[model samples]
Target: MGALPDGVYHIKLDDQQFLTIGEEGAVTVLPAQDVGQKFEVRRASGDNYAISKPSSIWPSPFVCYDGAPAAPYEGTRVRLRVSDFPPCEWKITAGSRPGTFTIVVAGDGQPLTIGIAPIPIFPPFLQLTSSSGKDLGWTFEEAK
Candidate 1:
């Protein structure tokens, strides 16, 4: 109702579709016609977006990649890990809410780098973790 913050926001697109945006300016299209339709917001740039469907509609849990269902206590922790080359990257299309999580990658491979916009422009928690479920010691703090 009031002025929206400077970040990505999700809006219902019809009764079966949704659109997600990213701070880097990407747009993702989601076609969810059923009540349990699940999708993931990866990244967004300009007017385009990227997304992934990890599960079928209904009671099944949804995740970006094949893995165990996230524990309830994990809260908004989006886990990502890479062991090979190709330079893996994850983008968060959801807007900058205080508790909203972007992407968290960790592993024992190449060092990962996180990037985000300057403060007052973007606010999101970017983290990296290890393959053993440990923090990979990387954080992308918003620049002042």
Candidate 2:
């Protein structure tokens, strides 16, 4: 798919694991539950989409180290900042697997890639790695 249509969705890495955004703007992959795993995908002026919490309506905007609107570099930790509200322009491009998509970091003009095999914990999520990897962790399904 080119870009995910504007709507609310539960980001999924598989049938079980889901990407959950915390109140303090921390992102994590959870096993179950529909509490904080939902994000509002809203189309911006162009191909970018704003991801946010449904209840709080806080936008998940990606910011750089200096808190700029540019794409993040490799190994840079990302977080949702309300100050930027709209965040970086994310390009939803086709991923390495079917039914999955790579969230292109418009800030850095590159796709959002996961780190090494061990996987990352909470707090500050790991940064993007090789662009050719199959990171289904970024794949999300439209919530009902």
Candidate 3:
């Protein structure tokens, strides 16, 4: 797998759940939809990309790890942030499965994986976890 072409996309996990923007900008996984679920992926440098919600209100924010790089570990959630700091970028790379990719934090190199929500009622969310698991694969479908 190579770097994804710059464009808008619907990021899916294992072809089942789509990466969605939940209330207050939390990133969660759920069934696919046509609106408010798309991400604008722009190549910042090399394999690094800035993933953001184009449909968001003014001063659009991009997804990034929620903790400091020095302390990153499993369960570090990804959230939409309104900053241009280094942590706001991600290293999108080839994943364990074909036709999929793993999104890694640019600052600490931790791969984003599927994680259970703290509250059972909420859907699964994306979090920084060990790359040793089978949950790091994600598919990028160009949004039409």
Clashes of each: 12, 3, 0
Candidate closer to the true structure by TM-score (higher is better), 2 or 3: 3
Estimate the lDDT of model 3.
Answer: 0.74
lDDT digits (tens) for residues 1-144 of candidate 3 = 666898999998878888898877788888877666898899886667888887446566778767644556678778787654434667788888778787877654445544444556667666777666655488899988
**Residue-wise lDDT of candidate 2 within 1-144, one digit each (tens)?**
556778888877656667666556656566768587777778866776666666553433432222445545666554556643665556666766777776656544655554323444443353556575556545677788
lDDT of each: 0.29, 0.59, 0.74
lDDT comparison, 1 vs 2, better candidate: 2
TM-score of 2: 0.74
In candidate 3, stretches whose alpha carbon ends up further than 4 angstroms from where it belongs are 55-58, 68-71, 84-87, 108-121
Against the true structure, whose TM-score is highest? 3
TM-score on alpha carbons, each prediction = 0.19, 0.74, 0.82
Candidate 1 per-residue lDDT over residues 94-130, each given as its tens digit: 3244433333323334332222212242223222222
Q: RMSD in Å for candidate 3, one decimal?
A: 2.8
**Model 2 steric clash pairs:** 70-107, 71-107, 71-108
Q: Candidate 2: which stretches are off by over 4 Å?
A: 55-66, 107-126
